[model samples]
Target: MMPPTSSAPHSAGSAGALLTDARLGKKPAPRLRRYYLEPGLRKELPKLHQILAVDLAHVVMLAERGIIPATQAARLVDALRDLRADPEARLRIEPERGSMVLQIEAHLTNAVGESDAGALSTGRSRIDQGATVRRLYERNGTLAVLDRLVALQDALLALAARHSRTLMPGYTHLQPSQPWVFGHYLLGFANKIHRAFVRMLEAYHHLNLSPLGTVGGSGSPWPLDRRRTAALLGFAGLVENARLGRDIQYLADIAAAACLIMNEINDLATDLQLWSSNEFALVELDAGYCGTSSIFPQKKNPIALEGIRTAAAQSMHWFSNVLALCRGMGSGDLAMRSPGHVDAVFETTADMTDLMTGIIETLIVHPSRMGARAQLGWTTASSLADLLVHQGTLSYRQAHHAVGAFVRHCVENDVAVTDATAGLFASVTGLDMALTDAEFRSALDPATFIAACTSQGGAAPEQVDALLRAAAADREADRSWLDTEQHRLASCNAELDRAAEILAAARPAGSHHHPDLAHE
Candidate 1:
């Protein structure tokens, strides 16, 4: 219903009263249900209602029939089942003079039960139903995105394994500071993605709790079996209080999940953009994933990466929009009908999944180019500084300062550090040492330096292998989780199919007293 309006009382005795008394005044227009439900959501609106009505009708019928205890019919179960069957459902909101009313309209194409009572009767309010639908959509939506995230991780792991010994120049301040295996570098981002997946799982768990039975931000007089519906809809449990179910805290939790997805996508896009730049050029995106320039035929822009970056930024902004929406509303303003959070969440989540999957699937790794670049640019110079510290010739601070001076001298004089003599080293650092050409060569070899690092996450091939094995195991676990979730969803859908048939068969019967009764 539209926001409340103002009206003044008229004196009953005059001609004005007679003129005004002919009818109960014009009825307010039905606020199109889709205005709140359809703007950004992926699921169609009508289908959502069909699914919801059927499932809830079954619950109502069972309760009416005494086939099951009233406690077995949960609003959460009905909402969940409805979403699975038809992600888009529309309900009617009829506002009278003093109070608002809700009922599901009959005779729609998807309508199964002919009995108007099956669709129109509601022991609960639309506020709880809407909240429950949003929550179910969010929880499942995140799980779907998480599946893609883990798949991308698998792709990154494969890249790391393929390039475990492929060297690349690792930079600080846009200049080469050290050399590392490309696999080692890729694994760093993989770890970040892995953590993002974990965050998604945490959000999924929180969203899984059912909020369906709460009526108008308070408990209803009619008994609502919160837990049984939770089980039917695959929710772990209920959030308890009706008001708490639609509370700001619950909305914020949903928003937090959206932020997490956006952040991960932004981080990925940023890395891809930097790596694809001409200045870095350690890797070139495949032409299939790049866009052509309007003026420069030679320019191959990483538009997908850039688009992903922009989309992620936009999603975060929308998350803030929803948060602000929450701030503006009252503690129990259930009638506001701002399901923007649901729409925003589904759109952002779907975009994230598409971007993550696209990036991983089409990424082009150039091990040879990365290795050639790594070997150039004096990237091993840092090793020389670290070597001096290891040899106890200087403290790390002294060695750092000495190396900085040497780098400056070589850059100014247009000379290579390898060409500098042992006497030059003595002159620069005042170390009483006579180093040979072999020593200079050894210090400049990045492969030698990397191999010496034997730590858990080091660039050494052996260490990379160990980490890769662990990541592979984790990926397997992630796959199993996805499969289990899919199976559960499939079971929910199957139940809806059966329930739809039962309702369809019972529609023609004249004597059925309840929504859930099976047809003769």
Candidate 2:
């Protein structure tokens, strides 16, 4: 299925046409309304209804405060509830109405007189409405991204647990540098994703503030209770600075968090792509995640991973677009409120996170091939140097030089480090000391190399196990955060529903008019 569109309500062609016709003294071109304007409204209608609900709650608050007459507020609330209850039957926007708000106002004016219907927008503007909707959209989107990230982290931790001692070749500059287990490698990704999750939560905290009371980048003339509206909307607090409430800098925070996530996915994809190649032959993707080439029957392409890589790149482009759109725009400019651009970034980043999670969860590892490759690259040379240092036979630098020379001699003589003789090491180190067969084997053993790395954040099995346990705890914390935010949003929506119901009940039944409004 296609992802959701922006939360900003589109301008209705009818509203635009009526205004333009009044100013120009002629019917506006039908093509613009039919092709450009109408289609946009139709696409945005679903999310626009959500913004309408928020507006209704604001109107109810106005009534309670005596800012608008209680009778008028009841009529407006009833109409709003009727429209919201059966949006397909009651909410309509023709080329004569310009927006969802205008459409609603027109309906209410026709249903309960112009004075009562018009009062619904007493302390609100399309500008602040748009900003508020975007925040709601972002708040929802951030939670979604976090949910996927938490799942991805869990998947990684599970995979890492099973492969704690599954030795693999760790690389530097695309060349094998040392021996490490698959578990340790996966833990690295888990740690990175954990950091991304934390950053997203930070961004979520910032975006959850309400901009409802800051109508048109300034406080409304009426004494609107910003805090009450914010509480009703599930926002943590007001944006405080009315002017700053409309700024698009929050989009930058979102973009930064998304970029961090996609970049991590890109790195993981690169590694998987390399490992799945014939040259590496270290991993086998599940058939569910792979595709066969149309022209080559033997080809089992990692198409899913390739798509993830491409999605990561696309997210970067979308992030750049958001940055550019908000770069020079004023706080309340239309450019600062480009919901479509910002939504694209969120959608793409979330897509990649889900895709990568699937890849990690299902991909098959080749432990034998990984171990064989790990042993082929003289990956234990550093271990030998360490052994030399620990034995008090030579300083670290001297041991490093000795091991370097010994590796070159083995390479030149077509001898594997595991098969080299004691005489060979002595010749290279220019020492008269004798080395035992057990010592030679231990020095070249991948398992020995991995076990010896017992530093705080090392590849040793014990260290990896510790890291894995810590990551599980971190994942639990992230899940708890997601749950808390979800409950907050749901409770806010429930509160709004209750408030609307109360206002609607104040009016007598059947007092409002019903029209066969088109669902535009």
Candidate 3:
């Protein structure tokens, strides 16, 4: 909303007036329409119906409090219901209007006559109403993302269960460093996505609060039933500080959470892109997700991975821009509070997550290729070094140096480490080794290397199984919370509908006036 030049923002002059021409004493510039008014109408067109949804609650609360005549409120409710049932059919844009809500106001006034339609804004400002509406819409967006994340968690856990002991090369500095269980790799990302679930829930807690009844950043003179309206709207509670209604810092919080999800997505997408390469050949995306080059018939590019990566890359600054727009500007600068890009951030991240979920569900993993890669680059050398320290009288450093020398000798002689025996290590290092050939060769075996990882959070099969169970438990909790919130919102909608219907029915067929309803 455009802040007023004089009075506090969200005031009659700033927000509620249909008299932009009369108050400003001039027509809005073409640039104002070109940039803000026209685009806001088009961009907000899909949600124009929501204006009635908010106003219904507001009108019902007004009639219940006897702030307006029952007859007038009934006329308004019936009109609101008609327009809301088909907003596109009932509402149209006029170039003179400054906002979509203004267009709605003009349309509603026309439908039910001026006095009754105008009663909807009695003790509220568009600032709080828009904030409430944005929160409600964003709650829907957040839950949508959570729904996708749950699907992703299911996919990850299922794949992890299938590959619990599937040994693959673990990488550091883009080089093979150790043998890692494929299940462990997937579990790590599942945990990361769950963290995003937690953060979004935290955002939802703040976003679910009601901002209604805060008229122009000050409490209304009317004995407004703020709590009642909040209940009707399904808000968790009221935003008690009227001034905070104008503080949209919660948008930055949501953006920050989305940024984290995108970061994890980028990491996974980049790794999968690298893994799907001909050289790595460890994993292959489904043909449905891959795009073939028109010029190169042999190419089956992982376009979905590229798409996920591109989506994440562009949204890294969503939260940053939100913070930038909100900070240093005082509360009176209401326009700074609502950043539009956060919606795009959530939308893109949800798409990326959903796309990745499909990729995971249909992914093709080459166990043979992963096994081969796991064995190359002397990935099991650390096992040999540890074994030497335990069996021989060498300190840890001495054992590491001895193993390094043996590795270099094997490379020079074109000997695979798997082919080396105790005699070969002793002959190369001239060290008296207590280990037998079987024990020495076993230390270099990838399967033995995996079995030996008995630490609390190791690559061992038991450890991965326990972690998977924990992930399952956490995912179940998240799914339950999402379900509860969805049901609550649905219940609130039903309640709001029932309340509007009752108030609309209070008017008689030929009743002259509702003097009793004013105080009823």
Cα-based lDDT for every prediction: 0.61, 0.78, 0.81
In TM-score terms, which candidate is top?
3
Q: State residue 434's C-alpha deviation in candidate 2, in Å.
A: 3.8
Better of 1 and 2 by lDDT: 2
**C-alpha displacement of 162 in model 3, angstroms?**
0.9
Off by over 4 Å in 1: 1-25, 29-103, 106-120, 334-336, 339-342, 417-421, 495-520
How many residue pairs clash in all the candidates, one count each? 8, 6, 0
Q: Which ten contiguous residues of candidate 3 have the minimum total lDDT? A: 511-520
**How many clashes in candidate 1?**
8
Q: After the best TM-score superposition of candidate 1, give how far the Cα of residue 296 lies from its true spot, in angstroms.
A: 2.1
Error of 2 at 32 (Å): 5.5
lDDT of 3 by residue, 252-354 (tens): 8889999999999889989989999998999999999999989999999999999888888888889889888876556566552356676787688788899
Task: Write down the TM-score of every candidate.
Answer: 0.79, 0.91, 0.93
Candidate number that wins on TM-score, 1 or 3? 3
